[model samples]
Target: MPSSRHLIGELESANLLGRGGAAFPVGRKWRAVAERASGRAVVLANGAEGEPLSLKDRTLMATRPHLVIDGALLAAEAVGAPDIIIYVGAKHRAAEAAIRGALAERSNQLRSRVRMMSAPDGYVAGEESAAVHFINAGDARPTTTPPRPFERGVDGRPTLVQNVESLAMAAQIARGIDANTGLVTVSGAVRKPGLQEIDLGWTFSDVAAAAGGLARPVQAVLLGGYFGAWAPVDEVWALPIAAPSLRARGFTLGCGVVHALSEDACGVDATARIMAYLASQSARQCGPCLFGLHAIGECVRRLAARSPQASDLDRLSRWSGQLAGRGACKHPDGAAGLLGSALSVFADDFAAHQQRRCLRRSTSHPASLQPVAAVA
Candidate 1:
């Protein structure tokens, strides 16, 4: 195995970014834990894929469990940590079984330091603080920051929480392989909706082509997950899917979710339903997330149902500004961002819905909005 300094140096050189949506630098994260450790640090392999549109992590674990295990082991060795935790999603039974079965094949020394736990079902359960909190307290909800996972985690020790794909990439990098490829979860309107392995050079268009093309003429795409916003088809059709590059361009490749909206679908209606889902998944640790998100979700829900009050749209814009930076985690901010995006990408639809109309090209009754699926 490479030394801690050597491996971390390589990670930095390769610019390995987290695949868990944050796009945080992998080396910096491991270094923070390594520096804070007295051989007491912990490595957490995050397979708690709570994003409804994302299945890359669980699929990776089920099909390539050994790679994930190797990455976890590498993370532990590189960070001078004796303990490794495979924090997989509770709903991902096949992944859990695969990970456990793979661990059984490892040497006693390697297996002894590793343990597996089922993360609770919900989106917030995938947050870094939430993962640590769950391991230490049996509750899978995000906690307030300051003593972040790096500063303190799991039994009050520094921890490195990494996405499973990022770790798989790490393992590949360790073997002198280039980690230039990524996995994207393509859902909604694609003929074959599932995982698409993409090169760093691939664009959103390529992703679409790989998924067997769109089933219909898409109006827009819900890039990232529910926390992300809708991008008009023209705006993102040719956009690069590279996480870091996308972030630089004011876009987020969150959790590798790329959901296409069919031409016949209502963007406003989809956004509204997604908002409701996100609000329901709140950690409920703070008022902004608990109450404010509910309020925003309710407003969108009413708008989707074509019964918005005179002030619903105005309140959405206002509440987005009001709720940002006031939550325990970034949950409220994410919700606000999504709402903001919806208001922009679906402006026409919002206005039409206000007048009991739908802009869908295939609408049977143009004056009445139809029930649309929410990125299903």
Candidate 2:
């Protein structure tokens, strides 16, 4: 294998970011693992599409299994990992089958060092630390971090847990292919809800138009998945899908999900449902997560139900602010980010809910993944 420096430098030049929501720099991550690995590290090709509305990862794995395998092999070699694990979600049968079959066509030496693991289905199961914890303990829940996966992971060896999409892009860059696109999963009230490979700097309108345009009047867009914030549709329709661009505008391209919220749906109601879902997915490892999330969910639930007491609004605002940086993992932070964004994005509706004068809207589809047809 070539020196890790070469691949890492290429990735840096390409300015690659992880596709699994965090958008961390790919080169920086690889450089860290390369530094930590002592020929005993493990590489995790995370195909665990545990996020409810996101299907870009599995879409890539099922459609281009070889691409994923190539990236994983490259990562193992570059990071000095002797073994690689393809962690596909237990429910992602097609993706698992694709990779399994792809591996069968590879060389014997490559096949022997790689293994497949069933990732438990949950929002947190795909998290890097949780993925490691699952491999070690058979329980796919997040553990507190200090010794991150790169420092110490499976079998007490440093591990590199890169998202499958990130791996694929790395492979593309390695092969001198243009790696300037990001896969975004578009759903909710779109005429054609599916996964599309978007140019990183394309405007949101372009992505939406590619999804067959809007099926209804969209009031706002959930720019990121549950972990990301929401912004008024008009306010962000011109913002580029690129992470740095979105971040400059006080938003993130979280998990590459662009779910359009219909004017027929209530953002407060939608947010409440998401809050409850995130709360239910908690690992129950710490107080802030176990209790605080439940409390926050209940408050939002009351607001959504149009039965909030006066103090409930104040509590929701304050509690969400206090929830960040307090959990065992980022689980609480995700919930906080969603709730905080809702408080701002749907402030008018929230106030309406408190005044018992809320308007009617269509039902929400929080888990509406639908079939992810890749944009050709």
Candidate 3:
């Protein structure tokens, strides 16, 4: 086995980035913990797939629990941390059970060092700071930064909170393998929506095809989860999935979600529903997040229902700008990103809705805006 330094060096060489949506360099994160003077540290494997459209994390935990555990243990050893905590969403009972079963198969010493905890079921509850706060205070809300988790986390020690997939990749790197593939949850309007292990260079259309292709032709794809942006089908279907490539095109492969919106599904209506959910998921810690998001959600809902006044669109646009960079976490910014992208990518749809001429029939009862139920 390679030493921790060698492991981190290999991660850097392979350019492994966090799969937890942030895409931070994995090697740099580990080195920060290893270099800290405080030898007291902890490792957290985040499997709280709180993003409603994402199922990749829980799917990995269920199908390959050992790999996730291996990655967590490897990270614990690399950072000189004696304890590892696998944080799963309370709703993900199967993932929890799989992890516990995986833990039981490890050596007594390894089992003693690693434990599992159930996180609250909410979007922000999976944030790194929120996970640390929950471990320390039993509250899963995001706190102010500067004393970031890496600097002061669980029990006032440095903490490494990594996504389960990122840790899985780390485990592979430890075995002298370069990280090139990612797991994407291809949901929404697909004939066979499920988890897919795809190469970074695969085009969006290729991933859709691997998922048995679309059940209906799509107008746009919601890349990433709710926190991610939208892209017109014409623009994204042939685009590469690599982070740098997506970044250059003003997109992120966040939480590895690729949701398609069929032509019959009004992009405006779907975005409105997601925006409302995002608003409700806020920690309500800041004014911009609390008030700004709610206001934006209401405006989009009106626009989607074709009941918006002429000024509603302008108001939504202005609020999107006002809410950016104002939240304690990135919740507000992400909500803004989703709404802004919808307005831009589906401008024609929005215009049609404004004139009470949506292409799809609006359901008499709006679809319930709730997080996707946890799957086994």
**Taking the candidates one at a time, how many backbone clashes does each contain?**
0, 0, 0
What lDDT is reached at residue 350 by model 1?
A: 85
Tens-place lDDT per residue, model 1, 81-199, is 88999999988888999999988877575832898999999999989999999999988878888889888998999998999999999999899888789988887777777788999
**Which lDDT values do the candidates have, in the order given?**
0.84, 0.85, 0.86
Residue 134, candidate 1: Cα error in Å is 1.2
- Of 1 and 2, which scores higher on TM-score? 2
Model 1 Cα shift for residue 330 (angstroms): 1.2
Question: Cα lDDT for residue 180, model 3?
Answer: 93
TM-score of 2: 0.95
Better of 1 and 3 by TM-score: 3
Which residue pairs overlap in candidate 2's backbone? none
Kindly list the per-residue Cα lDDT of model 3 for residues 272-310, writing each as its tens digit. 889889989989889989988888888889988889988
Query: What lDDT is obtained when candidate 2 is compared to the true structure?
Result: 0.85
TM-score against native, each model: 0.94, 0.95, 0.95
On residues 71-156, what C-alpha lDDT tens digit does candidate 2 reach at each position?
98888888888899999988877888888898887857583298889898799999988999999998887778788989999888
What candidate 1 gets wrong by more than 4 Å, as runs, is 107-112, 361-376
Model 2 regions lying over 4 Å from their true place = 1-4, 107-112, 363-376
